[model samples]
Target: MRYLCLIIAISLSSSAVFATEDMDAKLDNYRSAVGKLMKVLKPELVNAMKSKGPVAAIEVCNTKSPTMTNAVSQETGFVIQRTSLKPRNVSNTPDEWETKVLNQFEDRKAKGESPKKLEFYEIIENDGKRQIRYMKAIPTSKPCTICHGEMIPPPVQAKLKELYPADKAIGFKVGDLRGAFSIIDTITQ
Candidate 1:
């Protein structure tokens, strides 16, 4: 009986330790991936605004990067079918996470607070397994304002409309939530 108790206690304690370590590693991966993407995106956005204009820069972001989309898939089970300045219809795949994050961002703006590190969890099923995923929103910077700001320049606005007819991704300021770091089952390995 003493040996059985000792063995059980050790097993439970070890499992708990492993769980903690797993969570830590997952978060580290999430941060590393997001950090790498931002490092690349920030400079490009700044340069685009300085040389090309806000619209041009945003265009680059729209087509060029899949940091958010890829992250959603890798972290969560869901695939981001589309992320537009405005909402659009897709034959399949709902934009549930993106829409929720965006709405939270707008609410934060209305409350005169910068949305940062906003998080939420979603339960999902993948390959017959149940999983929980997390989503986080981080604000855009000063440079981001030019494209997603309250008052875009006329030319920039025109370009935005042309590019994103149903665009709803505007009316933001520096330090306001531009988007989020969505995490899914892609928790730590």
Candidate 2:
């Protein structure tokens, strides 16, 4: 009886350790994928803003962002995208899970957590398949204000209206949580 109980306890403890390690590995991979997406997109945006201004930068986001995200997804094997409460692109609007997560992120930010450090991940079962979902918050910065701030330049506003007629992604200040990079992947057990 003592040996049986010891074996059972050992098994349970080892399973717990394995689970923690697995979660940590997944988190690292998700972080790397998000980092790659940002690294690829930020330069294009900066150059567009510097050379062609905020209107052109908006165009880059409208056109290049999706292509870049898809390429990253293909490379990383993670289905990745961006989402927000107030989305500039209609398609970038949060889904049900994303909405809940984003609201939690907002709460965290309100409680004085740094938006740059905001992130969340979890394992969820959907339709009988297990998956890991991760989100990393994007904070509004000084340059972001050129396109996303309260007082947009007329040209930038015109271009934004042309692209997103019902745009609601504005009135942001530096340090605000703009949105997040979200990644989801099936967990192969």
Which candidate wins on TM-score?
2
Lowest summed-lDDT stretch of 10 residues in model 1? Answer: 85-94
| Candidate 2 per-residue lDDT over residues 61-151, each given as its tens digit | 8989999999889998889999999999899989888999999999999999989899998777788777788999999988888888999
The runs of at least 3 residues in candidate 2 whose Cα sits more than 4 Å from the true structure, single-residue gaps closed, are 1-18
lDDT of 1 at 53: 68
Q: How well does each candidate superpose onto the true structure, as a TM-score?
A: 0.65, 0.88
Q: Candidate 1, residues 11-91: lDDT per residue as tens digits?
A: 998545446566666556555555666677678778877897676787667765555556545653543333333432122
Kindly give the number of clashing pairs for every candidate. Answer: 10, 0
What would you estimate as the lDDT of candidate 2? Answer: 0.88
Question: What TM-score would candidate 1 get against the native?
Answer: 0.65
- Which portions of model 1 miss their true places by more than 4 Å? 1-18, 67-114, 120-127, 186-189
TM-score, cand. 2 vs. native: 0.88
